[model samples]
Each structure stands twice: as structure tokens, then as C-alpha cells.
Target: MRIAFIADPLPSFKIHKDSTYAMMVEAAKRGHDLYFML
Candidate 1:
């Protein structure tokens, strides 16, 4: 599946607390194609 995330800047995400980052990680584990947009 293809997943596009329209979110804040990538570098600004804190792995321990960012929900978007967590979702991205899960998507990656499932082998989805991910695109990040500012």
C-alpha cells in the first residue's frame, strides 16, 4: 500500500513521543511505500 503523511518537518519529530512517527514506523514494518509532505 502507498501511504502519504502530511506532517511537520521530519527532523522535528521525537521518536519517543510523536504519533506520526510511530505510525510511519508501523507502515514501514508492513512494507508500505511512504511519502512525507511538509
Candidate 2:
């Protein structure tokens, strides 16, 4: 399956540990194609 995420930019520090990043990471691990949009 493929998944995409669209979100406004997070604060710089927040990106490192943000939930969105985690979700993307997990999705990639599970073999889902991911895309990001502002």
C-alpha cells in the first residue's frame, strides 16, 4: 500500500522527534511508499 502525508512545516527541533516523522518511518519500514507535501 502507498501512503502520503501533507503537513505544514514543524519547528526545526520538532522534526527530529515528531509523530509525523515516526509515522513515515514506520510506513517505510513496512514497505509503504511515502510522500511529503507542505
Candidate 3:
């Protein structure tokens, strides 16, 4: 499956407790394609 993640624009960001990042992690584990709409 193909998945796209959109995130807010910021100078710096943290991955901890980030749902989008967590989703990407799970998606990768499931072998899904990832695209960031940054």
C-alpha cells in the first residue's frame, strides 16, 4: 500500500511521541511506500 504523511513546517522537529512518525514506522514495518508532504 502507498502512504503519505503530511507534517507542519518548522525549523526543528522531534520524532518522539509523533503520531506521523510513528505511523511511518509502522507503515515501513508493513512494507508500505512512504512519501512526506513537507
**Pairs clashing in candidate 2?**
none
What order do candidates take by lDDT, descending?
Answer: 1, 3, 2
Question: Using Cα atoms with residue i matched to residue i, what is each candidate's TM-score against the true structure?
Answer: 0.92, 0.70, 0.75
* Candidate 1 accuracy as lDDT: 0.96
Local lDDT at 32 for model 3: 98
* Per-residue lDDT over 1-38 for candidate 3, one digit per residue giving the tens place of the 0 to 100 score: 99987886534556786777778899999999988787
Write down the lDDT of every candidate, Cα atoms only. 0.96, 0.79, 0.79
Candidate achieving higher TM-score, 2 or 3 = 3
Give residue 6's error in model 3 in angstroms: 0.9
Best by TM-score: 1
Residue pairs with colliding backbones in model 1 are none
Query: Which digits, one per residue and each the tens of the lDDT, describe model 1 over residues 1-38?
Result: 99999999988888899999999999999999999999
Q: Give the TM-score of candidate 2.
A: 0.70
- CA error at residue 30 for candidate 1, angstroms: 0.3
Off by over 4 Å in 3: 9-11
